[model samples]
Target: MSVEGKAKEAAGYVKEELYEHGKPPESQKKAQEGRDLRNEGRVEDGKPPKTTKPGTSH
Candidate 1:
């Protein structure tokens, strides 16, 4: 199967697994918050916040 097809199948499997073995609401909320934070540049590569030197730009 193509990469997209495989990804879709994997997503379905994960959804079903989470439904069956879901975490507690608070933990799930915290997890989702972390996801949002990462999306908003709170963390990088599972590490702490990134730092940049003054007068430097990327």
Candidate 2:
């Protein structure tokens, strides 16, 4: 297999390991939570969640 193929397979294995034994990283979890809240039209402390345009740095 090519190097790229091996890297992809390794990444899949790591994902499966994490799914079986560990939580996803906190930052990713938080980001998904924020997205879910936004989709639900939730406001925290009277302020809507801040959003950023894709491909733009904060």
Candidate 3:
């Protein structure tokens, strides 16, 4: 994944960990943004997007 994407993912992960009892909407949004960015980067690199089970981390 691209550095930016990885960074966003890490931020999201931190947020999730910090709020383990309940994930804020922003956290989920950040995570989705990270995944989308990573997928875009993969496409630009001429590779397929990585797949994961729904509701699971990449």
Candidate 4:
């Protein structure tokens, strides 16, 4: 699965629990929007932050 997929899947679980408390975590919205943007190949406006983190050498 893509990063967004993983994020959304995790968010879904949190969202379910949050609803009982009448609150939504920002992660839920961010995850959903990220999924949409990634699907369209326009992540962060095609300009992701520069990073030297391992596993991210593109």
Q: Cα-based RMSD of the predictions, in order?
A: 12.7, 16.0, 4.8, 11.9
Model 1 over residues 1-58: C-alpha lDDT tens digits? 2454444444533443344334778655554444344333433233344244312442
Off by over 4 Å in 1: 21-58
What is the TM-score of candidate 4? 0.31
Candidate 3's displacement at residue 13, Å, is: 9.9
Stretches > 4 Å off in candidate 3: 1-22, 54-58
Q: What stretches of model 2 exceed 4 Å from their correct place?
A: 21-58
TM-score of candidate 2 versus the correct structure, residues matched by position:
0.34
Error of 4 at 42 (Å): 21
Ranked candidates, highest lDDT first: 3, 2, 4, 1
Model 4 stretches with alpha carbons more than 4 Å out: 21-58
User: How does each model score on lDDT?
Assistant: 0.41, 0.43, 0.57, 0.42
Error of 4 at 50 (Å): 36
Determine which window of 10 residues in candidate 2 has minimal summed lDDT: 38-47
Instruction: Compose the digit string of candidate 4's lDDT tens values, residues 1-58.
Output: 3565445445543443444333456645654444443334323234342233222445
Give the per-residue lDDT of model 2 (tens digit) for 1-58: 2454444444543443344333558645554444444423323224343365422554
Q: Is candidate 1 or candidate 3 better by lDDT?
A: 3
